[model samples]
Target: MLKKIGIKDPEKQMLKLMESGAVPYRGVKQKDVRNALEERFEPQVLKSMTDEASLAKRYPGVPHEEAAYREMRRLTDELNSSDKGNLVEDWYERMYAQRRAGSSNRPESRQHQKVSAAEWNKNRPASEQIKKDRFIDRVDSVNIGGKEKPALHEIKSTKGKLQERDKEQFEDMMKVAKAERNGVEARGADGRMQKVDQVVYTLTDPRGVAKNEDWIVDQLTKYRNNLSFEVFDAQGKRMMIDARSLKRSKDGELVLPDGIRNRLGLK
Candidate 1:
């Protein structure tokens, strides 16, 4: 294209264009942009805008909306904690050296906090760091509508197959559980350990009526004469008790319904 326009060295020309902020596209010149920023904000504010350290120190307790400030504060803490070395210093400098352009006043796009140096230190391997970044970045993208996670792959139940050794270890755990006074350990088909306990029922009504023996006895006596009420019989079957035959116990305690008593084998 440049040759057709009577120009040679198109690559060099493109480089010059990019350097001048004109070739790739007509962007605001660096000088003009800086001048415009200065006109819009105070000098101190402009300095803070470019320098992360200055931004944090200037607005240490600013609201979360001021992400740049928060990021700077976090980075500052990381910088202080790490060894006094070129790697950390260079990392911080490289991070803040770039000028940020704001297209809008909304801060939703900036909510993903940058990866901290501490995180980077823990994830020493570049591959691990890349994976972590991808996970976080993908999550941020979904949250901000920059990207949507595929529905099918969203819920991954398993990462890899459970090894035979893990299965043996789980079986050993179950054996150990058998000797315990309560609770039993068992492995599920999904390779997860599950604890089982002897099941017991207790009424959980918050009104406390279920817990009051006297109240229960009174209610049972009042309902005893009602022939329409049903009760469970032996062999796990429902049966109706004749109102005339539903007698109150001499002890003033509610007698268990025949059906329930049969199920529990209680006299």
Candidate 2:
């Protein structure tokens, strides 16, 4: 007979939970599991329930349907720490960047003497249409007789006046992810020597807000739960991308790609 480890019968109250089918927590040690059954009241469980019930209460007369964004800023830390959230924000930011890349983000616009770097950086929309400018320069509708294999065999540009900057950012994200996987060193000071494990994209919806593109209102109703997420290096030229991603879950935690993280102004 195999040696029986641990108490064969749990304490009086623990009998029900250990009976079967009651595992929901993560990184739970065996002893912790038994103790959990013994104690009817789990602090983690209570805290979770408390957090849920909090949504019902509201600050009265906050004006403009938002509570000054301060309470939410303080609370979204849980979402910020999740994997699904990271991915959704990334997609949102990339799209936002593409839109901003066009319009007034002209390269030479910063030549004026009076503008401080912070002021310029803060006010600059995604005017740098690197993708549009490059694609326009490189693309030709029909290949001439001397063309090797045609510049590209496929093109999947979106319809509807094609936003420029968002596409660039997404493409840039893919490239940075690929480069880091290939072991190529990126140049810079604080971000230079660091190994990038993941990338975070914070997408804020600036529509209908009093401020001009200053904050992300929120994600679509359906996708909010899986918003704070991430991507990981899978192999030579591929990565593990989660559409509904998060930083951590009931299973494990995730890190963002270093290069892309740096590019997106994340650590």
Candidate 3:
């Protein structure tokens, strides 16, 4: 009867259906067979089936273990092809880099393991820790004093949209910053000149960045502030000018901000 219904491995399929607890009676009516086939053939349903990890527990060793391993590898491959996967990969690289740099002073026993920022603070005295309402410190590597230190092993669900983007823009911005560190020539349009600690380039997105220009600039500004880097000017450089400093003169032409005027000691 099972073969008449087109079941290739009627005996095996019957055993599986019975094991699944979906079929009770050994008599096995046509509707029951049809229901099993319908459930098995649905792709969406199959994709959402119990994960291979759970399968490993039910069917331990040999073929089940091999199948579970292959499924895990396949799922990992699929994840690595997506935006989130790229972020996770980059974060792991950063964590490894920090660990290799010896930036963390954690004990020998804990050195090898990855500890989340939240977990790191869990048992510490309140005076020794900063209370974080959310897990922003869960970044793979966080800036500790002036050194970059790895803080967490596992990627928490708390990371927001910022992790989804590439850090290429930040890298390119750092090149301009390096020049500031070397020495920037601040030449004004009116033939004025001065040099400062670091030049902030405005209206510019770093290499490979073509979208969200304004938001990226704002984020860069915020990042610079957090890094304790002072904003500076290039002689007559508008890109380095603060938005607040950009104002309309009596003639309606764009003029430098009041801060710039004060910096230049102008009225």
lDDT string, candidate 3, 46-154, tens digits: 2222244554654456354243323323333233234333332333234233344443332111212222336435555543333332222122233334433222222
- Alpha carbon lDDT of each predicted model: 0.30, 0.27, 0.35
Candidate 3 accuracy as lDDT: 0.35
TM-score of 2: 0.20
Candidates 1 and 3, the one with greater TM-score = 3
Give the deviation of candidate 3 from the true structure as CA RMSD: 20.7
Q: Could you arrange the candidates by lDDT from highest to lowest?
A: 3, 1, 2
The C-alpha TM-scores of every prediction are: 0.15, 0.20, 0.22
TM-score of 3: 0.22
Order of quality (TM-score): 3, 2, 1
lDDT by residue (tens digit), candidate 2, 1-267: 001112344344344555554743357787677455524433222222223233234434433213312232323323323322332233322322233335341111110012122332333334311132122111111112321111111121121222446445434332332332332122222222332222233222211111211111122122232222121111101122233322443455343334534333432
Best TM-score goes to which candidate? 3
Residue 26's C-alpha lDDT in candidate 3?
60
lDDT of 1 by residue, 1-267 (tens): 223223467567555656676533346686665434323323232233335455456556553225342332333323222221222223222332222112222112121123333444352443223222211110111111332111100011111233454334323322222323322333322334443211111111111211332433343354332112222222213232223323456875445455434443434
- Deviation (Å) of 208 in candidate 3: 9.4
